[model samples]
Target chain A: MDGDHACCEGALAAGCRFVAGYPITPSTAVVERFARRIPRVGGVFIQMEDELASSIAIQGAVWAGKKAMTVTSGPGYSLMMEHIGLAVMTECPCVFVNVQRGGPSTGLPTLPGQADMMQARWGSHGDYEIIALCPDSPQECFDFMIDAFNLSEQYRVPVMFMMDECIGHMIEKVTIPEADKIDVTPRNYTKLPPDQYLPFKPAENMVPEMVKAGDGYRIHVTGLTHDYRGYPVMSADCQEELVHRLVNKINRNEEKIRHIIATDIEDADVVVIAYGITARVAVDAIALARKQGVKVGLLRLVVVWPFPEAVIRDLANKGKALVMAEMNYGQIYYEVERCAQGKVPVLLAGHGGGDVHKTEAIAEKIVEANKCLS
Target chain B: MSRTEIKIGGFGGQGVILTGFIIGKAASIFDMKNATMTQAFGPEARGSACSSQVIVSEDKIRYPYVKRPNVMVMMSQEAFNKFSPQIDPHGIMLIEEELVDPAGLPDTVTVYSIPATRIAEELGKKIVLNMVMTGFFTAVSRIISREAARKAVADSVPPGSENLNLNAFEKGYEWGLKQLEG
Candidate 1:
């Protein structure tokens, strides 16, 4: 299966009952699959007029008690920003897939890029946290999409399924497990009656229980600041409380949410930190460096946002230099550097867009970073 | 094998991508080697030439695109002219006899030609030319086993068309063997 097709299968397995999307290259396969299969699966796949409608339509489905998603590329992603912020503010549980292409605006329509990593984290207007996952192959694309949906359901926030064009279009063998073997997290539906329910009331986990609008509940959900009663509470105190709750829900549960694969790190003098397609490239580079007896490790960031700060800090504390490999002009480099906190020199094997970096270039960087062992 | 890169090229509607797919499937699924494929083409769907690259390796394939193809399969004159320049000097070349002309290729490059379209035409469907080419590729290069390619051909084609495609495969394979023997 190709990555996009695998993603569609993953969504189906994860119990996504509704999807609204505007098709764009590289990302179009997801919607195309959904449109074809949703009829048989007894779900709805809506082709909205444009990206803005596509973004908001899924939120409506989510509020109506449906697991939902919207897929897009660069320009579509940019248009969906306001809705992403709306999702964050209203605490909507949904998934968003960005099959990234080169772009500030409509850059490389059919090419690969990882420039949207930072944008996936901060494109929406606000001081809030989001969960973004990067999958390196078709198998990971299938597996990690389930995790994306499960995380979105568990925490009432939009999960970003960040894929690059290379992974989206690349074909590889993917083994999909039987449906019964898959574990999916169901939504946190409130058991309270209409009169007793407080829609915005936080549970012990800081995520409020959900109630469908037409379920005879007093639902007054709005984009503006609201209180536990789901009414407009226009004040600085309410603003502070709401923002803190939204951000801290993800920040406080970072340990539970962070999924990273750390390999060969015990005796390593340098590490390569990367995610998605770049991680595959790093694998070859690390192998090449190993041929010369350099013990380099890899920290594959499965979860790109709520950035894996503690792991990077520990590596820095142990005096291990880091190389951040990405297909962008230093977007994640500064983030890694911030986490390293000047403890060790951090290098970047960066490709601005269109194609992946050569393994030799990454291997050469690993050799140079290993010089800090002394 | 350490790594073997293959590029198959033709006009857009010639199942160019599908040809790359079967090879990858054969190597990775049946032969147990890892294979990765990526494609490129112009905007025109039929007349414009397109190409798909596949890398088969004992280890995982990192770079998805071909750097320089160790083997080239050309099914159209435009495809032959456009992509033959990047072939490894000693690479194996597979050509569709009627559609491509390989006059400028190096003498060191081992050439294998099969009338895949004519064979498919004889088999009553020109759409299976890619499958015929795939059979020729497997027979000539032996990079992927014949049994594996046969299994992949059965798995990749549409339902009810398996027999037609398998026949196409056999025709190309037989022709490839005779081309090598003669």
Candidate 2:
């Protein structure tokens, strides 16, 4: 299956029964695939008039006690940002596949871009944390969609699968497990009586049990700050507690949430950091540099958010220079440079996303970093 | 040795991207080699130029893209003009005679001209021309089992649309196998 469609199938296997999305280039195939296949599998798929409506509908489905998700590209993602922030405040569990394309505004309708990296982090208003996964290939797309859904339910926060057109359109062989082979994680519902339930109270694991509407639980949800009873409060204390729990659920689990694939970074003088499609290029550059007898390694970031600062800082403190490569013009390089903190020099290998970075271009940067050491 | 890179290009709807997918899938599934494929196409569905790149490597593929292609399958004149210059000297070129006007291509690369469209039409459907060329390429390269290519094509296509594709893939494979011996 192509990468975008693979996400749909992966979600289906993961037990996603509701999807609400607007049709947009590069991401339209995802919705179209779901529209055709989901109903046959007894899942609900809806095409909303706009992205805002799409996100709200998915949130509604989530509140109604279903594993739900939405798909969109750049412009659509922007429109849904306000609602994404709402999902954060409401503590809703859902998944979003932002198959990113070139954009500030409809920039490259059909092209690929990782330019939305920062947007995924801060596009939605307010101070809240989000779980975002960056997948490099179609197989990764399938695997990560499962991960995205799992994370959303586990943390009770809406998760983002920030993908690009390159991964979405590229077709490949993905192993679909037999019916009984799949493992699914369902949302935890309150077992307590409706009158006794505190909808916003954190469970032992910090993830709250979701009480959906019409369950006689009297669940009251809002974008405004709310208390454990799910009622809006005007006090600063309520705001602080609400924000604290919302951010801390995922933030406190950084050690568990930060996933990275590092290759040969041990005992190396230089390490290259990359994610998404650019990580693929960085791997080739590291190998080529190693062949020339340069001590080079790679840090491929699969989980973009939660930053993996500890791992990066450890590599930097180990006395290895870091080179950050990304399809955007220096979005992730800032984080690497901050972590390096003059412990090791950092280099930026950036692209504006119309084309994939050439391997030789990245290799040249690696060689230059090596020359500086001597 | 460097991994061999193949780029197949043609007007949209010629299954150029699917051709690349078969190459990548064959290498990974049948030969146990690492393979990666990427594709790009213009806005127009049929007349627009589309292409897919395949990289075959003996090692685990770290970088999943081809910087310079070693084999190029050009199914249209425009595709040839756009991509032929990047073909490495030791590479091979396969052109579809019905679609491409190969007037000035250099002889440094081993070039095979085939009437893939004519063959597909003779076999009863034009859409299977891509599968025929896929079989021909697989026959020459031995990248995957010809039987595997037939199954991959049949399995990939949606249900109820398999019989004609299966026949076309078989015809193309047999034709390609014959060329290798003759």
Best by lDDT: 1
Off by over 4 Å in 1: A372-374, B41-47
In candidate 1, list every pair of residues with a backbone clash: none
Q: What is candidate 2's local distance difference test score?
A: 0.83
* Interface CA root-mean-square deviation for model 2: 2.2
Where does model 2 sit among the CAPRI classes?
medium
- Give the Å shift of residue A165 in candidate 1: 0.5
lDDT of 1 by residue, B3-106 (tens): 99999999877889998999999999999999998886225334667899999999878777898899999999998998999999989999998898898998
Give the share of true interchain contacts found in each model: 0.64, 0.52
Mind sharing the TM-score for model 2? Answer: 0.93
lDDT of 1 at A309: 85
